[model samples]
Target: ARNGFVVNGALLLDHDEDKLANVLPRPNAVTNRPWAVLGVLNGDYPRLHICDRTVTFGRSPDCVVQLDDVHISHKHCTIERDGNNGSALVVNHSSNGTYVNSRRIEGTATLSEGDDVVLLFDRIDGAMHGKALLGQQRVVDGRGYPVLVGYRVISVNLLA
Candidate 1:
C-alpha cells in the first residue's frame, strides 16, 4: 500500500516534509520556539531580538528592553511565549498602557507574526504618545504626524 497523497497533480510522499504538512505554521512565525523583534520608531534604534520565554519592556533599568522615555513606566509590559507553537502573549502592566493594532490592550493579547504592536504613553497634557508600526503615519488631531508606523524593521524575505 502506498502511504502518500497527491494535490494539484503533485505527489506528496510520506517524508519529513509530509509529516509536518498538516501543521500550518505562519510564514514568519517561530517554529520550534517563540521569538520577537523589537524595533523602535523609525530606523534610529537597533532591532532587538526576544529569545527567552519571558521578556519585559519598560523604563526600568532591570527591564530586558529598557527605554529612557519619560512616558514609559518602570514596569510597562511583558511578552511571554504562550506555547511551543510560536505564539506569544503580551500583557499590559502600566498606566501608560499598551496597544495592538491601534486598539488598547485591556489585559493581555496574543501576538503573531507581522502584528502591529504599539506601546502607548500619556503625555503631560493628557495626550497620548507611543511608537507605532513603520510606514503608516498616525494622524494625531488635525496635523498629520508623519511618525513611523508598520513593521518594516526586518526584511520579510529572510523569514521565508
Candidate 2:
C-alpha cells in the first residue's frame, strides 16, 4: 500500500523573466517570468532561463551565458525566438560548431522538447575568446593555444 505514485523523471521549475520583460520593455520595469529553461546535461552550472529575444552563449562577456571554456569562441552560438511561432531556434555561429542530438548543425535548427545540444570545439585558442580569425582552418591569429572545451545541453523547455 504505497501512498504516492512513482514519477519517472525530475522536473525543474524556473521563471521566465524575458517574457515578462517584453510586456513593458522599460528599463525601470521588473519582470520575473521566464519563457524557457535549459538544463545542463553534465556541468556544474545552474539551469539557464530564456531572458531575452536572442540569447547568446560563449566565452565573451557580451554573451548571455559566459562560459570560461578556452575552446569556445567569443560569440559561439545563439538561441533566438522564431518569428513565426514564438518557438526557440538554435543557431550555430561558432567556428568550432554546435551540435544538436549528437548531430552537427548546418545552419539553423528548431529545438524540440528534451532535445540534446552540444557546443563542440576541436582546439582552443585562449586569445580568440570565441572569435576565430577569418579563414577556413580558422586559427585565432594570436598567442596561446589552449585546451578543448565543450558543453552539452541536456534538456530544453519552451513555454510562452
Candidate 3:
C-alpha cells in the first residue's frame, strides 16, 4: 500500500548539493500537497518544462543548467487528463517537436508513471519528471446499480 509519491534525481554527485536537494518542493507546494517527483540527470534539454504550475522555456531552474545546447520552444502546448484511469500533460508541436521516450507524440498522448517526457525546440529539449497517482479513486455507488456492494481497503492499489 502506497500513501505518498516522490520524484527524486537519479544522478549522484558527492559535492552536488543542488542535485541532492529536493526539486519537488516547488511543484508540491504549488500543487498544495505532496506528490511524486521524477529526477532527471542526463538527457537532451527540453524547451518547455512544467514543474507543478510553472512552465520554464529555454531555461533551467536557477541552480540547474541545461544538459546540452539543445533548446525547445514553448508554444501551443497543454496538459490534459485521459478518461478516469490515465492522465497526460501534452505539448502541441507547432514548428518544433515533442518526444516521449524517444517517440514523437503529435496531438495528444497519455503519460504513464515514470515516462521520459521531452519537449523539443531549437535543438534543446526541456525534461520533465512525470508523476502519477497522487491520490486514490474512491467510487461510492449508492444504490441504482445491480450487484452493488460496499467495501473499504487500506491500500489504493488493492481497490482496483
Candidate 4:
C-alpha cells in the first residue's frame, strides 16, 4: 500500500551514515526560563499544546506528551526549554532514534519552526495519521498519512 511504501522509504535514509545529522553542538542554555509556547502535532493529537519547563515524550503515562504506540519507546526523548533565550533542545534517549527535519539526531537539536520531527521512524506501520496528513485525493482513498512516524513543530516561542 502507499502508506507502507511511504513509511519504508523513509527508513532507507537511516542506513546511510553520511545522511544523518552531524554531532549536535552543546546547547547554549541561558536560564531556567521555560519556552513561552511550543507545539507538538501528530496524527492522533493534531491540536498544538503549550510547553512547560521540560517535557519528556514517550509511551509512558508519566510523559507529558505520551505517544502510546508500538513505534515509540518508554522514554524516547525530552524537549527542554530551560533558558530564557528562545532555544529548545531535544535529547534522544531511544535506541530506535529521533529525526528532526528528516535527519537522524544522535544527541540533540535546537528545534526550529516548521521542522518535521519523526520519532521511531522505522516503525510507522501504516497507522492512520488522522488530521496530520496530506493530499486531499489520497486521503479520501485511505492513503493520507504522513511519510513517517512523527510530529510537526508547528510553533516555537509562539511563533508560527
TM-score winner among the candidates? 2
lDDT of 1 by residue, 55-151 (tens): 6666675665555566667877877666646466788898767766566688998866555555642243454454333345332211222232212
> Per-residue alpha-carbon lDDT of model 3 for 55-153, expressed as tens digits?
222223321221222343324333433335424445454355555554567876555554554443211133322321213432221121111111111
lDDT of 3 at 85: 48
Q: Number of clashes in every candidate structure?
A: 5, 10, 19, 1
Q: Is candidate 1 or candidate 3 better by TM-score?
A: 1
The C-alpha TM-scores of every prediction are: 0.55, 0.58, 0.37, 0.56
lDDT of 2 by residue, 3-65 (tens): 111111212223332232333222321124445566554333345555466777777766656
Candidate 4: lDDT of 39?
Answer: 29
Cα RMSDs of all predictions?
16.0, 13.8, 16.3, 13.4
Model 1: weakest 10-residue lDDT segment is: 149-158
Model 3 stretches with alpha carbons more than 4 Å out: 1-30, 34-36, 41-56, 59-70, 74-86, 120-160
Off by over 4 Å in 4: 1-44, 122-148
TM-score of 1: 0.55
Error of 1 at 157 (Å): 16
As a whole number from 0 to 100, the lDDT of residue 107 in candidate 1 is 93
What's the TM for model 2? 0.58
